[model samples]
Target: MLYLWIKAFHIVFIAAWFAGLFYLPRILVNLAEVPPDSVAERARLIGMAQRLLRFATVLAIPALGLGAWLWLGIGIGKGPGNGWLHAKLALVLLVIGYHHGCGVLLRKFVQGLPTHSPRWYRCFNEVSVLLFAAIVVLVVVKPF
Candidate 1:
C-alpha cells in the first residue's frame, strides 16, 4: 500500500514536471518570434516563461525524490538483472539536464539574447516529448 501510494504521487509529479517542460519551450518559440519593438508582448511572454520554469523546477524535486524513494527505499529497481532500471535512470538524468537547460534559455531571453531561431526552439520543444515517450516505454514495458 505504501509503495503504491509513493508510486502514484511520483507519477503525478512527473506528469506535472513534464507539463512544464513541454510548455516552456513553446513560450520561447513565441518569444523568438516577437518583434523587437513589441515591448509589452515580449515582457508578458518573459513573465510567463519565468513562472513556468520555476513551477517545473519545484515539481522536479519531489518527483525525483519520490523516484529515489521508490528506487532506494521501496526497492523498485534494485539488485542484479535490472538493466532496464539503469537505462531509465540515465534517461532521467538527461531530462533533468534538459530542465536546467530551459532555465538557461529563459535567462538568455531575459537578457534579450536568445541564440537560437524559432525553428530551433520548435525542434528543442520536441526533445522532452521524445524523452517522456521513452520514459513511459521503459516504465511500462521494462524491456532491456
Candidate 2:
C-alpha cells in the first residue's frame, strides 16, 4: 500500500517536473525577445518562471525521497545486477543537477544580466528534455 502511494507521488511529480522543464526554455526565449527597456514585462516573465520553478522543486524533492524509500527502505533494490536501479538513480541525479542549474540561471536572470545567450538557453532546454526522456525510458523499459 505504501509502495503504491509512493509510486503515485513519483508519477505526479515527474509529470509536473517535465512540464516545467519544457516550458521554462520557452519562457526564457520569450524573455529574451522582450525589449530590454520593458523592465516590467521582463520582470513579470522572470517571476513567473521562478514561481513555477518553486512548485517543481516542491514536487521533485519529496517525490525523490518517496522513491528512495520505496526502493531502499522496502528492499526493492534486489533486481539483477541492480542495473536498472543504478541507471535510474544516475538519471535522477542528472535531473537534480538540471534542476539546480535552472535555479542558478534564474538567479542570473533575476540580476538583470544576460549570462546565457538565446542559443545556450535553447541547448540547455534540449539537453534537459532529452535527459528527462531517457529517464522515462529507463524506468519503463528497464533495459538492463
- Residues 18-122, model 1: lDDT tens digits: 999999999999999999999999999999999999999999999999999999999987777778899999999999999999999999989977469999999
Model 2 residue runs over 4 Å out of place are: none
Candidate 1 residue spans exceeding 4 A from truth: none
lDDT of 2 by residue, 1-144 (tens): 878877888788778877887787777767767787998999899989999889888878777887888788886658676588788888888888888888888887888776767777778778777987788788788788
User: Which candidate wins on lDDT?
Assistant: 1
On TM-score, the leading prediction is 1
The clash count for each model shown is: 0, 0
Q: In order, what lDDT does every prediction score?
A: 0.94, 0.81
